[model samples]
Target: MIRQATPADLQTLAQLHSQCFAESWSAQEFARLLAIPGTFALLADTDAGFVLVRVAADEAEILSVGVRPERRQQGLGRALMAAAAERAFGHGAQTLFLEVSANNAPARTLYGALGFAEAGRRKAYYNEGGRKADALTLKARLPLGKSA
Candidate 1:
């Protein structure tokens, strides 16, 4: 089931992100965002595990999302994306945008399958320990009927 996230979920989200991303946001950052106007967060919970996400405005950029590493490729990511899209459209978003690591093939494929198109790229957007990673900017334009 998908539902709005509370501040209590931040710690688990932070830990999940640490396992998924080379660099992760602090719990404090997530807490701060949770209190911001126009920011939206959602989580999917099941017997297996959960996935969490935060988007900004109705036209949101996916701030972060992750499922338990042990549960990867079991479709939780897709579930989270679908939930975010629904929330975004319900809130009057015309388009959803996100920046995925250029090298993350699985995420790119998942986004592409869900109607997201590569709109642009940000070169060397993340630098960690002398290594750099570029970002692929993707967008999914929603039909007018889907918007509030």
Candidate 2:
């Protein structure tokens, strides 16, 4: 089931993130984000996936998203993205943005399928082991509606 996340879900979010990324964020970091005025998160419990987002004025930024490695390719990511976008729009966001490593084909594909388009790029944005990777900035226009 998908549900809005509270600060109490930080540890679980951190654990799930660790399984998906080489550099995982800590519970403390998650707490800090949660404390931010415009930030929110959504968790898919059974699917072991979560998405963090922050909305300010008419814009929303997706801070992070992850799914347990074993849980990927099962629509968990898509569900999380939909939830986050809906919530952000409800919070007054007209546009949603996110950054993905340029080399992350799967994630890029998913974002593309969700209607996110490339908006910009950041050079040497991710550090993988001793190597660096560029980041692609993507943005999508959110449907006009209240939060579901």
Candidate 3:
């Protein structure tokens, strides 16, 4: 189920980020975003796993989306992404963007399949434990009506 995330979901979301990303945000930070106005957080939950997105203004970014490592390649990520896109469009978004580590092939492939194209790159965008990692900025135009 994809729904607006609440403060109660922070711990689970934080744990997932720790498991999925080399560098994770602090619990306080996650909670802060949830408390901020104009910030939208969505979570998809089930026995399988969970996926999350943070949308601000007309741009939506995938804050954290993960399936237990054992459940990888089972389509949970795609489902979460579809929900994110739908929600973004519903909330007046015209475009969506995300940053992925340059070496993350699976993520790049998934975004490509979702109509996200490589729009640009940020040099040394991430600090991995210590070393620097470049980030690829991917973008996709959300379905918008003539009025948008």
Candidate 4:
């Protein structure tokens, strides 16, 4: 089931992140983000997927989204994203943005499928071992009138 994430979910979120990223965020980092005024998170417990977002004014930024490697390709990422967007809109967000490593084809494809468009790019934004990867900025306009 998908649900809003509380501070108590930090360890599980961090564990899921570790399986998805080469450089995973720590539980302390997740705590700090969650403590921020506009930050929010959602989790799909059974699928081990989670999405973190920060909304301010009419804009929302996706901080991170991940599913355990073993649990990927099962639509968990999409479900988490849909939940996050709905929650952000309910919180007054009119648009959403996120940055993904250019090298991450699967994530980029998923975002594109969800109607996110490339907005910009950041050069050498991710440090992968001894290499650097570019980051792609993506944006999606929320259907404000349908928000609940």
Candidate 5:
């Protein structure tokens, strides 16, 4: 299950993000982003995960998506993404976009399962443990459906 996240979820979201990523977004950053128009956040039940997205014109982009380390591989990430797509579609978005670290095979598989295809790449976009990693930009038409 998923629910719309509010201001009260900032700390939880930041915590989960920190646990899931090498570099984390502070609660302050999440607060600032949430204040922007067309931005939205969704929290998975029990704070297992969350996805942040922004819609503009005919497109929506996943600003961030994270699942607690222990909760990964349980379909929580997929659920959060599916919910984000549904919300974005309702708001007039025709396509969804997100960027994933090229080295992250698990995430690449997840996005591919959701019908996302690589659209572009940013060289050395992420610095993890002092190593640079490329960021692959992916795109998918909404609303997201089950993978074959």
Candidate 6:
């Protein structure tokens, strides 16, 4: 049951994000971002997952996405990404972009399958304690297709 999320879902979105990442974003942060033009969120039910995206000019960037650990491997992430891409395209975007931790193999695989390719990199962009991981910036054409 995927649906567009409103500010009313802020707390739930924060809770779900906390389950998927070591660092969680607060509801206040979500509220601030959502208030910005062209920023929106899509929620897959209350317990499954959600994705946040911002479109500007001809480009759209995925700010964040998360699936409950238990809900992973069940296609939730793929569905969320596909939906986000379509909506972005509908909103006059010609390109979709996202940054994923280089250490996150599963997310890289999922993004790759959705036609995203490595566009650039940010060294040591994700730091956890003393452990650091590069952020791989990925890009795909709007209305994404499966990679050949």
Best by TM-score: 6
Candidate 4 total steric clashes: 0
Q: Is candidate 1 or candidate 2 better by TM-score?
A: 2
Q: How high a TM-score does candidate 6 get?
A: 0.95
Write model 5 residue lDDT over 1-148, tens digit each, in one string.
8999999999998998899887789999999999989999999979999999999988999999989988888999999999999999999998899999999999899998889999999999999889999999999988776332
Off by over 4 Å in 5: 146-148
How high is the lDDT of residue 54 in model 3?
62
Task: Quote the RMSD, in angstroms, for model 1.
Answer: 3.3
**31-147, model 4: which lDDT tens digit per residue?**
999999999888896748899999999999999999888888999988888888888888899999999999998999898888888899999989988789999999888852342
TM-score, candidate number 4: 0.91
Whole-model lDDT, candidate 4?
0.87
Point out the higher-scoring one by TM-score: 3 or 5: 5
Structural similarity to truth (TM-score) of each candidate: 0.83, 0.92, 0.82, 0.91, 0.94, 0.95
Local distance difference test, per candidate? 0.72, 0.88, 0.72, 0.87, 0.92, 0.91
- How many clashes does each candidate structure show, in the order listed? 0, 0, 0, 0, 0, 0
Q: lDDT tens digits, residues 1-148, model 1?
A: 7777677777766666677777776788777876777676676664223343344555767777777778888888888888777777777777888888887788888887888888899899877568898988988876423322
In candidate 5, position 95 carries an lDDT of: 89
Q: Report the poorest 10 consecutive residues by lDDT, candidate 1.
A: 46-55
Per-residue lDDT tens digits for candidate 2, residues 12-90, read 9888878888788999989988999999989996648999999999999999998888888999999899989988989
Q: Cα lDDT for residue 136, model 1?
A: 87
Error of 5 at 15 (Å): 1.0
Estimate candidate 3's RMSD in Å. Answer: 3.3
What lDDT is reached at residue 131 by model 4? Answer: 88
For TM-score, candidate 2 versus 6, the one ahead is: 6
- The ten-residue window of minimal lDDT in model 6 covers 139-148
User: Which pairs clash inside model 3?
Assistant: none
Give a tens-digit lDDT track for model 6, residues 53-126: 99998999999999999888999999999999999999999999999999999999999888999999999999
